[model samples]
Target: MTDVAPPVSRPKVVRHQLERLIITGELAPGDRLAEVLLAERLGVSRGPIREAITALERDGLVVQIPNRGAFVRVVSEADARHLYEIRSALFGLACGLSASRHTGSVDIELRGLLSSMRGAAERADHEMYFDLNRAFHRTLLETSGNPFLAKQYETISRSINLFRARALTIPENVAASLEEHERIAAAVTSGDEERARSLGASHIAGGFARHLGESVVAS
Candidate 1:
């Protein structure tokens, strides 16, 4: 591994890097966070790594054992279902509002985002696809003209930031997700508020089903 230069705030920087690794699936759920090894990999002492691990615990990205050290977090079946249900509601409303409030100006931006997402999905670039997926949804939320609702969505989104990337692990999920996006986009752009809302909610619900099928949840 190439060494990283030590930063003034090593713990913060290390935490962000570790968060990226876990969220991007490089450090898959249930993988251990070996402090000594990570210290060597990141060119820092174990102190920063330990500190970062503590922060990750608070961020809901890692589970810390009494003596075993940290591991990437695995969401419980109940927790996973709960989060998806909340997002389904919020996103469904956002999609409806986007269809009702938009004035046709966001079409170009949405189209460009969809094109990029298609490319990323084709290449199986889950990291890129995840980011673009967020951007696409954020754009729709913003077009809804509801700042309070958007703020609530973002808060909930950050709580499950890591969970979202894992859903794209299946190759077929990429195609299915893109197809859903296309339909949602069409409905929103066509000012079909009810259809957009229904599709938005179902899309989120479908992702959860795919995730469960792919072994993310326990029986």
Candidate 2:
């Protein structure tokens, strides 16, 4: 039998790696993403790098300037607020659906994630808490059983990643966020759809307020 090589999607691989770089803070917002540099670093040619960059741009993770080349998108405070508003609505819907469809196993899983997040926060591990926080919300959305809602939330969540970590870095914020998560989990597990929806929206709003406060401090 002739040996057939498995297909390699270089552009997709490059895109994933680039996304990790951005998410992990190795490539911060406003950092220039030079095609040549990325190509060399990823051990891929410029073609694949460019293709991956284009994909990221379409995903709202990168911005291309006419004269300044590509860079990680710098989401402004106003833009973040607007995005959070949309996200708040979507999260509320998803949580409401999840509350309506709650199961013992799903509830247990979410509670476990919240516990882990609390531990991370106690240890002052912002990165670990951030990742767990994402998992907690993602689990809720998936449990919602509404594919369209999940898809829309996923898109907004990705864009929100550009600023989510910054808001959670404050110790007090982390503590308060855990409390909110606890209430959200309680609502979902208890099958309180309205309360789940309200709490979910309020959580996002709180994050938005914290982000705005951070922007003010930075300015």
Candidate 3:
């Protein structure tokens, strides 16, 4: 019998884990990221952790200061707002494109996401709602058939999801968010390109505004 080899660690899995740590404030902004500490905590070798750190740096989740090694990236209200603006524009264009150009399967996926979101909201399951939200947006972007647009959308969306999750968890925010999702899904299904784009942009902007209003900035 041939001996089986252990599976190699995927660079992406490491990157995503580190990214979530940074985003969720488990590894807070400006907190030092020691390779040995992270490796021990994650039950993995330092090699994969280092590779993950490099990828996180590229993704703006970690920044290295001179003579100081890696630290989580800090986000200010202004920075958050600015990032949301870029995301809104990207998503808006993607939604409009998808509405105009998407085939049958994309529409079906959108409806499914809508149903799932409705159920999640009714159950008050924030995590599931958040996951479905990301899926919905990604589906719309993917259906656009513009590789550049889809790639950029995913990059921006991942970067902001941490803050967005916190913001959306505030009282009443989830209900409001579900309503917005319904509007977006309706517009997309009806092939209302302009309406879908407009609603999508508004949804992002409103969510950011709500977050900024409620958030207490800590230094």
Candidate 4:
């Protein structure tokens, strides 16, 4: 009879925690990821911390410098713009498919998210709305019934999330986004594929404007 401890998954756990900090802005862009400090804070050895950092780098959430160690990546404006362009196409397609494929429960869930999102906007709860906003988009993608599209969108979303909170910086912007989401939800739920496609693509475009600067919101 052997009492064997399960295989250690410390690095995977550390990676998820570190990834959340980076996404939620606790570890801001350009923040140094000192392996020793993280190792001590997470109550593990430096080996696991280093392994986690390497994983984050591959996820495009952190960067490793030859001499300076790892840092949370600062997503550039140009890089964000390109990512947005690709997301717009994918999201629009997903919306069309979702409209064609969504079921009753999916419709109810989207409506619920819209309601929560509206309340969050009214209360100026940007963080809450940000989470719900991501949920709303993910629901549409998942309901689209295309696993490949969902997978690609999820991968791109991790990078976009580094700066997504910036999109909700102003109360006015939140209200605008709420309106856009309403239209998107309506289009999807009503089985209007073309409308859903247009609004979905345009929403991501508007999101980029809000993220970078609010000036283009009206455009």
Best by TM-score: 3
Give the residue spans of candidate 4 off by over 4 A. Answer: 1-13, 40-48, 214-219
Per-residue lDDT tens digits of candidate 4, residues 98-214?
A: 999878998899999999998888888877888899899899999999999999998888877787776675887888888999999899989999999999999998788788773
lDDT by residue (1-219, candidate 1, tens digit) is 999986568689999889888877778778999999999988999999999998888777889888787888877778878888998999999999999976757888888999999999888898889889999999998998999989888766765666677877678988999999999999998999999999999998888788666644433
TM-score of 1: 0.81
Model 3 regions more than 4 Å off: 1-8, 214-219
TM-score for each of the candidates: 0.81, 0.85, 0.87, 0.84
Candidate 3, residues 30-59, lDDT tens digits: the string is 689999998888888899998998888777
| The 10-residue segment with the lowest total lDDT in model 1 | 210-219
Model with the higher TM-score, candidate 1 or 2: 2
Candidate 2 regions with alpha-carbon error over 4 angstroms: 1-13, 40-48, 215-219
Worst 10 residues of 4 by lDDT: 210-219
Task: Extract clashing residue pairs from model 3.
Answer: none
> Candidate 3: deviation at residue 202, Å?
0.6
Ranking by TM-score: 3, 2, 4, 1
Deviation from native of the Cα of residue 182 in model 1, angstroms: 1.0
User: Model 3, residue 43: what's the lDDT?
Assistant: 80
Distance from true position, residue 113, model 2, in Å? Answer: 0.8
lDDT string for model 2 (68-104, tens) is: 8999988877677788999999999989999999999
